[model samples]
Target: MSIEIKMPALSPTMEEGTLAKWLVKEGDTVKAGDLMAEIETDKATMEFEAVDEGVIAKIVVAEGTDGVKVGTVIAVLAGEGEDAGSVSAPKAESPKAEAPKAEAAPAPVAAPAPAPAAAPKADGDRIKASPLARRIAAEKGVDLSGVRGSGPNGRIVKADVADAKPGAAPAPKAAEAPAATAASAPAAAPALVWYDESIPHEVEKLSNIRKTIARRLTEAKQTIPHIYLTVDIQLDALLKLRGQLNKSLEARGVKLSVNDMLIKALAVALTQVPKCNVTFAGDQLVKYSRADISVAVSTPTGLITPIIRDAANIGLASISTQMKALADRAKEGKLQPHEYQGGTASISNMGMFGIKQFDAVINPPQAMILAVGAGEKRPYIVDDALGVATVMSATGSFDHRAVDGADGAELMKVFKALVESPMGLLA
Candidate 1:
């Protein structure tokens, strides 16, 4: 009995991945929790861990193959009593969910050819068809309801769908359009992008991370209505507080940065102005009670945001420690799915780079992102007199659909108040 191994979704956003490397090849035995392969997901390269024990019968998809859709078979594992040499890749991927399974249940052998008078074909009016069959049937306008399935238990496979046609096939077209648009349907796709080969240049395939960033940012800008608000914040007080706190915490080996303090400020502000702590779901708004701040960290592959959960409630020292660890792991492409996936809002600090000010794009689902710039000494008013104060520029990009101009302004007002006072963050 041979079980198929399929590509797994390492992250919620991963629809496909590049098979970076295979740790085990044909004839090697593996058990649950064993690392079987390195799969490059949208956010990171994660190891595919086996969930069962079996002999590697064959490698269905070779390493270095990118764009392998999640659930697509990548290997075959021979179970006990099965001849490893005889086990081969099946003609079609089992209609099972394509999650990476180091050990999947053995594929059902053809039920000893059904009797002359067998059970009814329909299973409660639900048609049983392999995913591939459903796809081809859709592309060719074949109707499964009328097509006799030739697979196990009278299930429809690709071969069964080949000749079936529907006079009113438009119905299948609507439901299966998404699957048909994959690379396999290249003939129907148009070449909308082309570059000059005449120019001296090198072309490289976009990594999974880069591809995801491109897609997400495009969607965020195109679909979300953006409103930008800028505020000049005095950072002198925050800087003084940070210096004082760092000295007190030096004994504990915890040092804090301006970004760390700002993370707390943003989280606190979200709670104060709960209206801005939201996500825009079509036709409804989701208001969050806790402030989970997603801090943007730049990695070699691309920018990834590892979240700081309950930033408003945690101490600055803890925030700093977690941020440092998360940033380190993110740069190494080692962050797990949960580490970078969800947040109530986001904050991006480019102050370290000395960028005076810039607007940041809002991470989808989250209503706003705060962009921080460098703090520099500038003349400012001190109690009715002109004096020098360290000032920084902060901009809030809001989703107008969910957060109104007034609400965003209130949130920024609270954030600035917290930073300017500094003591409020400690509380």
Candidate 2:
């Protein structure tokens, strides 16, 4: 009584998925609710759980299988003691004795079944793990196919490492720690080695996420006609407001930042300039009733934009809290696709990094993006006097198809006024 296990539709737009890994193997028992596999879709990687208790009868789709059509029978589940390996595994045609080891590890490195090559080869080095396992291993930076499995049918369960003691496995004989470091540490500069001058390094292909970013950016640039708007904002008043607020809250736990103030100001301006808080949805213009602003945070992987829903209605304290939480989540790679998507507007501030000026690519759907730079003091004609004023440069990139020059400039003007006036944000 074997039951077919097909890939579930994880998202509305998902038509295919890369089987990331199989949690269970032939003859391995599984219980309902147990996480059985990981699937990488176009947007995000998600876990698949068991729906029924049974032994894995067979895995039809091996890990690293790309373009696996939805609803395909990837595996089979059978009642206890049922022969699970009765179904023949799909065999792929080989070119070399084994396929060339350097063949790109597919667009997705994660799949639910074992890869065609039992040895997971990365950079021509043999790796042993399901595509799903390889993805997890790659993410965790663990050398897979290198570690022995302790699960039924010799499958590597995620918990095996959790229960293992350190220094238990045999050290690798194929590679050794740098001889110079293992023997005696080298001085400040080591004698020039022949390898240092002409060593050739192989560059691996970009991961799916990186490829998607490159593709999206290229599309945005080529498809959208971009117009840049630059404006200088006086920040002395805003800094003064922050200092006063912090002074009043010395006993309180909140310390304020200029970026937080900028967020608040931007939110206010978006609310005033409703046109800027809209996306260029083809066939019809889509204007949002609320300002859901995505703030770009730089992570080790790349730039991730986390949304602050209804940012116009939130206070500066709340904005700070949300930004901190999103930044932490972005660094951990725990944010979901929705958490990093669907914003009517976006903001990228490099002021803290001391960047004087920069232009940002408009995150699609959203018609405009604002880039903020470091604040500096400069001579200005204020009222009737020539005096020193702290000014910051902000640039806006707008989709010409969606936002006109007046529409874009109006948003910047509002932002400049609110930031310079400072009290307008509190109002």
Candidate 3:
């Protein structure tokens, strides 16, 4: 029997991906661990590798195909003694595709299933599924037990859950409402939007990364009650410290950016004010002992936050080196899921762009995000006397549900002190 090669979930949350390119074509001989294709997920473009040695019989899914659901066969491999031309691809559909269709179904790009297939079957006592698939199932309210597995060894993948409908709910009481009220209910019509087409303009489709950014940002602003706090900090001490550190480490070839130091400062501040380092769940509050800082890096696709794990415990040199590597990979869309995933808090620096002050929206779950502004020479108080000094403005955006205004202010106070004192971050 020919072996089927399906689209793999490149990330924990990946449901569908674009087959950006294929490295191997039909008639090519491949061994385990050989690069087969490049898949573009919402966050990055990752290479898929072959797991079984065989002759490439056919490429089922063509390259440049976008929204290819996970577990959908993309290629076929003809084992030894099998005729390559005789090897046929498996029917490219999941069992849940047979479910009753709603009046309006979800968009194909969001969750595309193949042509009609068999009805979903139970997986007995154990339901096998990828982590990504399980998460997607929960979000869609789909029960995994009812979905049939299309993966190897009858494993459930993302495509299975994407095609499955949510489990049935208990019917409402007939006496609770008028029959006419229930029967006549209709969805509200969508509002019409107008654009000025008279002016010459070109429309471009949004990349997956851009689309995710739009959705997540909208959700963040809509769900999180944000409290903004601003403070002006003196940067003279930090600048001097950075110069000294750079001179000492010049032979090591490790140069630290101001953002690197700020990351350390923010981490240290979080540790000092533990109340601000938390994630707000609906029913509970999660407190983090270690400060994992997600530093915002802008890429060609969109903004991504590559994490510096345990920033409070690591040295400045390590932080600088790791951050540089992470930032470079982030721009190239080469960062892995773990590199950009969980963090206790975040920091975004717009200083390089000459932005003096702007409040940043909080990344969800995380209680707070520190926004750094440009440092400039300004009149300041020196030993109670007016003088000129390098000053910076920073704002902290906090989730009010998790962190109180006083706690947020305390974090800002500590961060300001660390930046002004400069030596506290080193400790």
Q: Provide the overall lDDT of each model, using Cα atoms, as 2-decimal numbers.
A: 0.81, 0.71, 0.81
Question: Scored by Cα lDDT, where does model 3 land?
Answer: 0.81
List model 3 lDDT by residue over 1-427, tens digit each: 7999989998889999888889999999999999999888988777889999999998876676667789888899999889999987675345234233421232232232411111121111335565556656655557666688775446677667776787842333464223212321321111122556578886454668888889889999999999999999999999999999999999999998999999999999999999999999999999999999999999988999999999999999999999999999998778999999899999999999999999998988798999999999999999999999999999999999999999999999999999999898887
Name model 2 segments beyond 4 Å from true: 1-5, 20-38, 49-65, 75-199, 243-256, 379-387
Comparison by TM-score, 2 against 3, better one: 3
lDDT for residue 27 in candidate 3, whole number 0-100:
95
lDDT of 1 by residue, 1-427 (tens): 7888988878776898888889998999999899999899878877899987899998876676656789888899999889899996766434333222311211222333321111111121446665556656655556567788775446676667666664442232453343323312442222223766579986454778897799999999999999999999999889999999999999999999999999999999999999999999999999999999999999888899999999999999999999999999998878899998899999999999999999999999899999999999899997799999999999999999999999999988988899999998888
TM-score of every prediction relative to native: 0.74, 0.66, 0.77
Order the candidates by lDDT, highest first. 3, 1, 2
Score candidate 2 by TM-score against the native: 0.66
Flag regions of model 3 displaced more than 4 Å: 93-194
Candidates 1 and 2 compared by lDDT, better number = 1
Off by over 4 Å in 1: 1-3, 12-14, 27-29, 78-83, 92-194
Backbone N/Cα/C clashes per model:
1, 15, 0
| lDDT (Cα, tens digit) per residue for candidate 2, span 144-213 | 4456755323445444433333332224344322221222222212333435546776434344456667
